[model samples]
Target: MARDDDTLVQLLTPDGERVDRAVGPDGVEYSVDLTDAEYRGFYRDLVTVRRLDAEATALQRQGELGIWASLLGQEAAQVGSGRALRPQDMVFPTYREHGVLYCRGIDPIMPLSLFRGVDQGAWDPIETRCGMYTIVIGAQTLHATGYAMGIAMDGKVGGDDGEAAIAYFGDGATSQGDVNEAFIWSAVYTAPVVFFCQNNQYAISEPIERQTRVPLYQRAAGFGFPGVRVDGNDVLASYAVTRHALDHARSGQGPTLIEAYTYRMGAHTTSDDPSRYRPPAEAEAWRSRDPIARLAAFLGRQQIADETFFAEVDEQARTEAVRLRERVLTMPDPAPDSIFDNVYPHGSPLVDGERERFNAYRKSFEGSAH
Candidate 1:
């Protein structure tokens, strides 16, 4: 079946500048006039996120981490949308959104601690305005929807210059029942939120076509909200679409859905072997359309940045990588009893019993060991 082409909104092409008369939403056209300072910030965000991801992957390979998820090619998608969010807007991210978490001022060490099996969450959700990384796939959608409902109830959606909530999920998660329910609730109640779906073509080993008969964005209409697809590799386009959707949500126009069409150029996680399921050619194809390189090319061609700037950014990335490696190596492992401490706010008798038993069992083989 032929899909609807008009549903996609792209302000910047990979080659730079707009082609095909691609317009953003009805009001407040998106800006491509990013000042040099803004461009430098974008460069820094991309470099640091990539470095953080690489460091995590290295830790997993070195047995410092139990597992890791690499967001190699999805940097622009995360950075663009992440930068668009206001300080007041909350973020609900899937596990691989380390880039977004970094942009939101959450420490990158949070992911490392979780992967090292030392902590459930190293960052405070309320303080960072970023919820815990939801590893259970699309379940965070409901949590985000509920949060948006509370925002609506509190009359926070339509004020403060169009502040709104945004939820981030992967392409595979679109099939989850919780995500669909979130859409239904958000649409029905007119929740002030945007569903930012990064359709990176594959959900682990499964491709997007296997999960949906139509484009993912089209699914939003069945739930009574408009949807638009943007070039996820184009940071400018991603920022434009998200800003527009968030503005719409903030204006009390109800929730909006944005499908960022991009590709994931790495394994699903460090534990998975992509060669077993994905063709090398497919990964190669997407690699040529690398999100970071395209942006660099655009900047260079437009004379917005030169080789010296890139060299400095690369150097900064190396420094961050070194720091991450050192931090991961030195992170203290949580005591066995730490797990029992946060299970219940008040307390749980069963947990207390288990803790005591475990302590006694450990002491049984102490200094007087056989």
Candidate 2:
């Protein structure tokens, strides 16, 4: 229900002006406090993440990657929210949250293992505080809720150092049973988890209108929790809203649903063509509100970053892209038997038996000369 005058919480306008948001009945303006260095750092991360996405797409086209999920227009949404999490907090992401993975301190090329027909994901969740990308639509929501329950059992909520969890999903997943169940479970337990939906306007070929009758954020009200929508294209808005929600979670508050109103600027994946479903004018309209460009506009207009700083960031992003490309190109192939190695924490006879059969099958081919 986007009327001409929408009420999506926005701090940085599409034209790069920083607008104020009132907090309570007192009319106090809610804002994010960041030093010049922090602002520059946010811009740097946005550039780096965008470069990473562009390079990954190009790599897929050049046959270095089997498929790439491009996070083109949603850089600000990912970067802003990702940075809002504390190191102690954990993250469960849908496959498209590559920018969040980057913010979580995982090596940018770790996802290459999955997309390149290698391992599912090659990093340790405990080490990175970021779970592997879940390919099944809304499945990660359930996993995140269960994990949050464990956090509650461990008594890790209600303090400055308390931990929280975040589940990242798209608009399409909102229609799934798993997502609804997650909502129920989290609400019942008052689990300290934030449901972050990057409503990029499309779930593959289907549009948002096909998913829900009302705004996505409003669905949380049915589950007995608070919900808010923020301008996904505005980095400052995304950051402020996420930081507040996460802070609330850590302070013993229940789940909060944040619907980031953004757009998917590219195809669903390397295999899909958005041109058939999405109109050119629709994509063009969002492009004028591009996240990265708007944040840069704010910086330039306020003199927060000089041309030299942007130039330096551009060079740094290129270096980062090159590093990821080189690493991905030379990534070693995993052993065929490695698949069964991590299938179980405790050994399972069924899995071992299957692995033995698979090994024998490969050995049968090794001795053939014909």
* The best candidate in terms of lDDT: 2
lDDT of 2 by residue, 45-75 (tens): 9999999889999999999889999999999
- Local lDDT at 182 for model 2: 98
Off by over 4 Å in 1: 1-6, 17-21, 24-31, 367-370
**TM-score for predicted model 1 compared with the true structure:** 0.94
TM-scores for all predictions: 0.94, 0.95
Clash pairs, candidate 1, are none
Q: How close is candidate 2 to the true structure, as a TM-score?
A: 0.95
Q: Which sections of candidate 2 miss by over 4 Å? A: 22-29, 367-370
